[model samples]
Target: MEFDPALFIDLFARTFTFWWVILPAIFLGLIVGAIPGFSAANTIIILLPMTLAMDPEVGLIFMVALYASSRMGAGIPAILVNIPGTAGAAATPLDGYPMTKQGRGQQALAISFVSSVFGGLLATIITLLAMPWLSQVAFYLHSVEMIVIMLFGISLIATIAARDTLKGLIAGFFGLMIGYIGADVVYETPRGTFGFLELYDKVPLIPALVGLFAVSEAFFVIEGESILSKRGKEAMQKAGWAATIEGVKIALSKWWHIIWTSMIGLVIGVVPGAGAAIAAFVAYQQSRAFSKTPELYGTGHVEGLIAPESANNGVTSGTLVPLLVIGIPGGATAAIMLVVLQYHGVTMGPDLFMESPELAYGPFAAMAVTYFIMIFTILPLARYMSRITVVSTIYMSPIIISFTLVGAFVPRQYMFDMYLALVFGVIGYVARKTGYHTAAILIGVILGPLLETYFLRALKMSEGDIMVIFSKDLANVLWVGLVISLCIPYAMQRWRAWKAAA
Candidate 1:
């Protein structure tokens, strides 16, 4: 498990030689990620035959490259059109879409691309250096600790609710109620499915995400001629490459923010079942809590955009740690990776590291190389991509609804999901028109089931004692941190008021 400099160098060189494989995967990943409901996991599943035909090492490198770039690509639509291509990008539009509305779409894309690439790259390097110790993270975090972590993400509902507490909470809790539609974890009893078998497996996330964000936005945008306002269109028309350059400069200026938020993603990714959605929200919440200008968040603030984009990409690296070290998949993509690796006869866990150290560590090296190449490959496109905002909503709305409906249908191939997406779209439109935050609702849907599962597990372990959540040392420490984080914003607000009076 010790870091071998020579081995790493060789791995890096070998990975570079696969630029042919890596480049294509990166491009494909970007395309897939830009389209809602298409993710690295499903894409890889479609290409399973091709991957199985390749050398195990080459196939793995391709998957790693695609995973990293896709994480970056999901942010593109989120920044330009307020559509999150993946759940990981859910937090992105809080600030990114606002920037797009203000005609700063190019800068937003530039900032997103730069932060995502560097965040993922730094995280990969850390993964390589700390592989031995980092692998133990999953083992250390049990259901109790995971529940706390889920709460950290769930707390984002409060953050979103700050603008209009009652409506936000109503939306969040309604989403939670929707999330509880499937069978109960322990008894398999249905809660709110209305007896449809499709609801047995819980609400399909792709349809829900597309319904709430893209489809709803499509419905709203039709009322306007363009997605941008008069000033926004003028600003965009006047914008040049300078906007992209300014974005990169702004992102680089917040290097420290990128580093820490990415670390949050890395840690969260280490736990099995923790996905990019949770990481992005937790990072955003923490970032806002510690910021000097919390009021500026949700208003196209650079840090708000940076926090989620960077953190989600950082998750790409963390998701692999458990798969490689403990033979457990951390997320959906990792689960698909496990299938590929198993088919290739690559044994996971510490034994693989001991037997085939090169194979064990090679994916990380390839991931780092993928991220490095992405800066050059994807960065310049930000200028052109920003122009997407200028397209007339007349054409854009139909295109969006069409693609999102297809996206909703692709994941489960259920015609019912397409209809369900329309249902959620109407719900989203109502929420938007009523001043409720869609993100809060989505958060509750995404994290509520996870919270319930972990909470149940912890209670079962403690013989149904509710106090078991505060029993473990690490859990207790995390609870204290959560309290401090929640209090920081209010404390800072009071400090500002006192300073103004003095």
Candidate 2:
């Protein structure tokens, strides 16, 4: 399909016309995203209803732009507080938190901002060039193929489950069971309602996510005496643009690392359900694998900050590709986006490009604009935001809990959601204290339903002949790919142990 210059220009104009909403959305999203526990997906889900009344295209632009920019925004708190604002930014804390302790917080924030812009822009370019072809490929996928794809996507649990295979699997199974609580898709039979009216619709994802990540995080953040108070205001004020420039120099010197990880992000982003957290983690791991001073990785290494930040942002754009072309969400943020698109009455898939290229391309242009704006907006404000780490826990505690509750309830305006949030908050706290990863559990929560729904559908359609899934060339290939993804981590873990023993 040929690019329509006139349509592209018109779409760009429309996107720019909504700069007022776009700008504030990005800015506020950054603040919310930077607050540990308030994830981008949760933020978007909470805010989605407000946008319901707006123009579809404008709403899409605002949310998508906010989603992309917030990935960078979340890094601020991750670096300063050793707490990730969003799951995607979790890897950022590995090196970012250490850097803050070393008085290099400004440098880490700067590198994260610059690398994120670079990765986001590069991914957008790839999205622009690849969307047409990808749309064509997505069009050929039948229901069975989609099911297989979802199963392969769910297998990412194995990579995530690496911390403790049994625990991970158990958490994932629980997530699947939770997802099954609502009415059955085919028979309308309630699976786990237990006579509760709310159970008829299953547990709402936004409230659960907000509770698990944000509200729980608030409790944890306040339980400890303030770490922020440790840094003097004068010392905290040292974070500035000078550090950012220094970070830029380091990133430029290691340009290859950025390019390689950005590519990794792009590839992972294109795969549905892979998400930014995985992209960031894998990139960080790969960067460490290739670094000359691998020992320096988790200890304030500049590349450690750059790789995951870039890769996660890169995945942001890649996540859009499948959504725009195939109507399939590539990540949690993208899944929320799918709702926004459907709410707007815009049907996705191959015909979307043919029928409403404007809607398809509007987000691409907005993402490019988001990248450009984020760099300028973040650099000047990084130091100021970093000082948030200095705020007293007493002052922050009530506010955090207030917003956490508000964020949880805003999505559905239901009081029951507040209780659900509280429950998940407790769950999150317990899990953290036990060394069980909240991220792994959240990943399961995000992907479990899709996996179970599709896998079961595929099996039933094939008359319980599970071999039909393997009978297809594409399914077989994905199955082998899943095996490789699982095995590599195990192999690496063993290698690391052996090297240490030697």
Candidate 3:
């Protein structure tokens, strides 16, 4: 449990010796993450044969670098084109797209890249310091507590209500119902599938996400010659290397915000069932709550862009915690790491460090080395990547629609998923035309099932008692925190109004 400064210092130095092995994986991750359908998990799965062939240390280094870098890459499309390359980057478009719309795309990209590196590096430090005891955090919150955490994320809808709370709530609840379309967990009873065989299973999220953000945005973009207007075009042309330097300056100024928001991702990610989506939303909500200019949030604030992006990468390290220390993978990506490590003859659990310190600490070393490599590799691309905004929508639209639809089908390989994506694209278009908040709806879609599953499990454990959620001290504390977080924003708004009147 003791922190060994010299030991970690040596490990850090040793990881850089593999820079030749690490660099190619970083570029691979950047490409995989930038493409809408290609997830790190899927890439890892596809490369399993090659990975298995490598020495375990080489394999883990390649996978870890890819995993960390991919988290940063997902933000690029979200900022420039309003398409989230990964589910975790869903929140990125809220402000990142807006920044792009205003010709700040290069800065947004820089901010995103820097924040991701900061978050991932800080999370590695946190993991190093707390890995001995923090893995137990998964046990502190049960299904009941997770339900509250889910609520904390969904409550972001209120913060993003824009001009109309009614429309936002409607959009959010509608997405929540859509999330429930699959068969019920308790019984095998189907709910809203309407007799489609595909509906018997859950609606696949990749297609839904692709349809909702990428496809729908493309549809709207096609209404004009370009995705940007004259002013936005002017901004895009103005994007340059200076913009990249400005972005680093902005990120450095908000260093504290990046640190704290990333810590939120780390803490939430340590819980077995929580992942980047939850961490990003919660960080965004908290960022808005504490902001002096909270009203500027959804309208393309830098804080808004950094909060979610920082949290997104912070999750990379926290995800490794439960896997290495507790033998529980937090999500599918972690599960792949777990499988690969196990296949390579690495053991998990408390004594892992004792049995094989090299294997135990190899991932952290890879991640730390990855952040160093990503800075040099990705930061310079901001100027070039930002230029995508100037491309004619006529060309961009068809490509986005075609490729994302392909991405949608990649996960399940069903023609039905392609159809489902078209359906959601129509729905997303309607939501966009209305005063409704699409981000609100998307977050709901992401969190709704987790909320329902956990709630159901908690109830079943309590023999259907409604009060089971508040039974534990930890759960009670979360209940109180959720209530306060839900109320304070409204209370602050009212206080400001009253002060203005006085």
Evaluation by lDDT, superior candidate among 1 and 3: 1
| Candidate 2 residue lDDT tens string, 1-502 | 4677788777767677777877888887787777644566777877777878778878888888888878878777678766566667767876887777666677777778888888888777777767766445444555566555544433454344225655655665566666667776667777777777776776776566666666666777776555433453444567566767887788777777778888788877777766777678778867875788866876778888888888988888888888877778877778888887788788887787778787778788898888877777777776666666666667766776677677667656788878877888888788767656555566556555566566678777888887767767776776787677667767978999999999
Count the clashes in each prediction: 0, 0, 0
Cα lDDT tens digits, model 1, 54-141, are 8899999999998888888899999899999998998999999999999999999999988998899999999999988888888888
Model 1 scores a C-alpha lDDT of 0.88
Q: Of the candidates numbered 1 and 2, which has the greater lDDT value?
A: 1
Cα lDDT over the full model 2:
0.72
Query: Which stretches of model 1 miss by more than 4 angstroms?
Result: 160-162, 480-502
Clashing pairs in 2: none
Q: Give the residue spans of candidate 2 off by over 4 A.
A: 3-22, 31-64, 74-104, 136-180, 193-195, 221-224, 228-238, 264-308, 319-360, 484-502
Error (Å) of candidate 1 at residue 218 is 1.1
* Model 2, position 308: C-alpha lDDT score: 86
Could you estimate the TM-score for every candidate? Answer: 0.95, 0.77, 0.96
Specify the poorest-scoring 10-residue window by lDDT in model 3: 157-166
Q: Model 3: residues >4 Å from true position, as ranges?
A: 492-502
lDDT string for model 3 (1-502, tens) is 4677887888888889999889998999988898877898999999999998988888889999999988888999999999988888988988999888888889999999999999889988889888877788887778988887777666666455435655766777777888888888888788888899887777778888888888889998888887676898887787668899999999989999999999999988888767887788788878987899988987879999999999989988889888988799988888998898899888888788777776777788889889988898889989988888889997999999999999988877899999988998998898888767777777777777788899899999999998998788877887788677667667877998999999
